[model samples]
Target: MGKKEKSYALGVDVGGSHITVGVVDLVSRTIDQKRLERHPVDSKGSLTEILEAWAGAIEPFCQHEVLSTVQIGIAMPGPFDYDAGISFIDSTQDKYESLYRKNVKDLLAKKLGVSNAQVRFKNDAACFLQGEVFAGIAKGYKRAIGMTLGTGAGTAYYHGTEAHDAARWGEEYGDSIAEEYFSTRWFAKKYQEATGKELSGVRELVDMKEESWVQAIFKEFGQNLGKFLVKFASEENAEIIVLGGSIAHSSALFLPETEQVLSRSLPGVPIKKSILGEESALIGAASCWYEA
Candidate 1:
């Protein structure tokens, strides 16, 4: 008998500043790392520029003969109509404002020389968690909350079978919404407020770890995160929590405090960092075509 042919799908992860595309092996639920492509994008660009950037990253994969017939699954940021392939993102958000009310599926399909049916979309946050749940750290857990703390805050809920966007970024929290408190902007804002100096992001802040103020800042962040998770996890009955994205790389600085706070209430709930990193979203996005 001949060896079975491996099934593949195209996965795309669209971020505020970049887009990543890869070929995913469905049976193994992993990305073909060698074939990965990434490109920087100006989210503030005109509608045509943004679409071209996304389509450009994805076009090469589709051109490969073996992948020509494969479906394309995209992990896109919200406010988007995932089912209809329309974008509702607006100027209020710093990214992808030009896509407001645009039919992205049709646009990308035309650009790629494919039909709209060949493309599918899922919330980026949900795709991150779904990738984790499908093959990463949360694989065995029945209920999990996946968080990506970076330039913005992303939340997703996995209900064992599938994951969905938690969409809690705008939910009320301390002085503002959860996004204000949990994102990179918050870290920069807090640091500037305390020292009257500018901070690029968490990476720069991490370098100043020896400073008492930096230590205090991380501890406070942990406390706030833990408190917020307590309520979210309790409501979702989350069995495990997986953290990813840029801020999560510095988790060691804040995880201890977060654990301390969780121990008081949601003790025994495992909190883990993503093992797959950026590939989580890629695999998750491609998995959308796994059953097809």
Candidate 2:
């Protein structure tokens, strides 16, 4: 008799603000019991505690008997030594000690008892873009760029499931091309300075009830987003650009302005909002394991 096909594997996404965990069934082409768990970055929690939260949130799915392999994918913030699967850089969460070292991948795999399993780690933006391609707005498009407009902006290029050996990916050094001066955080900073309102995140800044109040912020964001896309278009010559983030989801607030600006600057290349919400990373992580 032929060997039975493996069941499902779990995919986990760890962002600066939250974590998402899901189970993906390959043959069925469906996601099961996807969960979004929020965890803030803090100068607290030991390495074990942090990981326990990550593992524990996703553990329920692994208990399913049909899963042949416990595949785990992590979409982390930047500057990781992906080849070594290590996050050498420390997060703001460093208390008296840092959480991880050279063997984070090893540690995670061991803790999960996934010694023989596949564990992949890459920039969160790349995973976000991958999610865009897998289930978000960029599906079927071979060449595309995905920009995550969040606390900091991040961009990654992908040609379908494969990334074209990125010459530059998002990093703190300036967010490089992702540094759209008009990001929501940028707007909050400028709005707070210009309007004198202490706002939480950009979400409050773009409440949309007051269009005129937010017009300048949206306009500036459009200009910057447009300019950056033009540069990317010149380089990657991509056909589409996808955006995924909380800020991106509020397309009602700023996307029209963004579209108008890109239309003027980027002629043929099109810009689109992310269909996959915050769950994009979770979906992307699941795609990673399901594809392999």
Candidate 3:
């Protein structure tokens, strides 16, 4: 009898300033935390430079001569065509300017010496929820909402069996998006507006949770987040909401108020923090193929 072939998938998480890749075991739907490869990318650099850096980060996981039947799934940020694999981010963003209107799938496949068909792209936010639905907190939930609270509010909804992008819903907020009030930038901005002290990010503000002003800031943030959720929960019919990303790490600072608000308004829906942490994206990226 022929030897049973091993199945694996290369999952890549491409962020604004970094790229992380992993080799996920198909059957297990998980990646080795130790074997995961991460590298910083200069989004402001030339497209060739960024692509090369992404390829380089992934190469370490593909060192073996052959990865028979291995598939590639990339959790990519949007404002682009996911099906066409094109990037729409422009110079105005101060990042990925060189890749504006570029066919990312083909170019990335070429850089990695893989057939274009072997690569698939999905919104990073959807992948985040997908990862959670596959093996994290939402594993058994029939429906759920997921958000990444970082530079922006990356949102997704999982229904039936797949995660779908719900980021567009953020547009309802204002000229910018819901992210304007739901992200770390919002936290920083609110903090500075009140204290007149500039902060690099939410971590600094979280560290000062002991201060009454900081506590009030987070409480208000939680209330804002809860209000946002109330608007979407009914439309999404989500049974639970899970939060990930840099800001979510400080859930203790804000979750109490968030839960209180939800309990009063939305009621039954549960709000939880991501259990998989960083690995969720990698696993979720790989799940793109697994679920297909």
Candidate 4:
């Protein structure tokens, strides 16, 4: 087999409450995935354990294949010392031991026995953006921005040939404004207030399919994102912007408002929903493995 086909790439996305891993034959655009493997990351579990668990979770999917070399791409939460691959989880909201967590990239490689494996990492949200631009709705757009609305708001900018990357001003000032506005938490809270029910979670509200409540919450989300995009696009002069993540699925409720606001404030900035679905991260992260 050719060297290109022999080297398989692995992508690892570690999120606020879960770890997802994927193996891809980028040469043929073939992929395998393991999703949402929840860990006690916020509990007593060590970062070492979390890393190993993620590696092990992906091993079985590739065992039956003929992969000769491995490269790993890790997507992490930001404000991490990315150059050094050291990160601290938002233990305030999650369950990591912020004071004791170690270098996740090193640990993942060691536990997988790919200690010398080529690896690259960026903010998890950036991976989603890269995934979108590489093969999703935003493909071929040379200048664009990506925003993911989920547990929290996330934003990434792609300019020139450099695709997805962690924000230099992220995970700190990020949470103070737009990130706090478009989050699913707000939807849940609004739903709770609208229904006079102390929600167990957003899932409950989503199940109700209450149009009024949903529209109100998503309108706020769109307004927040639109305001943020106005600032971001004017600064970067991007051509297009896309949204992804779980909340993006509800674009019907948010898109019109978002577009309306963007049209009024930014005039010509084009914005749309991501087409990568959930696989964008896996593909983008795996593609980074090849680039590395």
Q: Pick the candidate with the highest TM-score.
A: 1
Q: Which stretches of candidate 1 lie over 4 Å from their true place?
A: 1-6, 66-68
Q: Score candidate 3 by lDDT.
A: 0.83
Residue by residue across 1-292, what tens digits does model 2's lDDT show?
1244454556677765456777665555456653444555432566777677666765665666433456667777655766577765565433313444656677766766666346777677787777777766787888898777776667788865554224343423235334536355576767788768876777776665477767777766766667666777668878898887767766666677667767786778788887776766766666665543
- TM-score list, all predictions: 0.95, 0.84, 0.93, 0.82
Clashes of each: 0, 0, 0, 2
Off by over 4 Å in 2: 1-7, 27-29, 34-44, 66-68, 91-97, 164-182, 208-211
lDDT of each: 0.90, 0.65, 0.83, 0.67
Once fitted onto the true fold, the runs of candidate 4 whose alpha carbons sit more than 4 angstroms away are 1-7, 28-44, 61-68, 98-101, 164-176, 209-214
- Measured on C-alpha atoms, candidate 4 has an lDDT of 0.67
**Which one wins by TM-score: 2 or 4?**
2
Q: RMSD to native for every prediction? A: 2.2, 3.6, 2.3, 3.7
* Model 3 deviation from native, Cα RMSD in Å: 2.3
lDDT of 3 by residue, 217-268 (tens): 8888888788788777768998999999999999888898888888887789
Q: Flag clash pairs in model 3.
A: none
Clashing pairs in 1: none
Window of ten residues with lowest summed lDDT in model 2: 164-173
Best by lDDT: 1
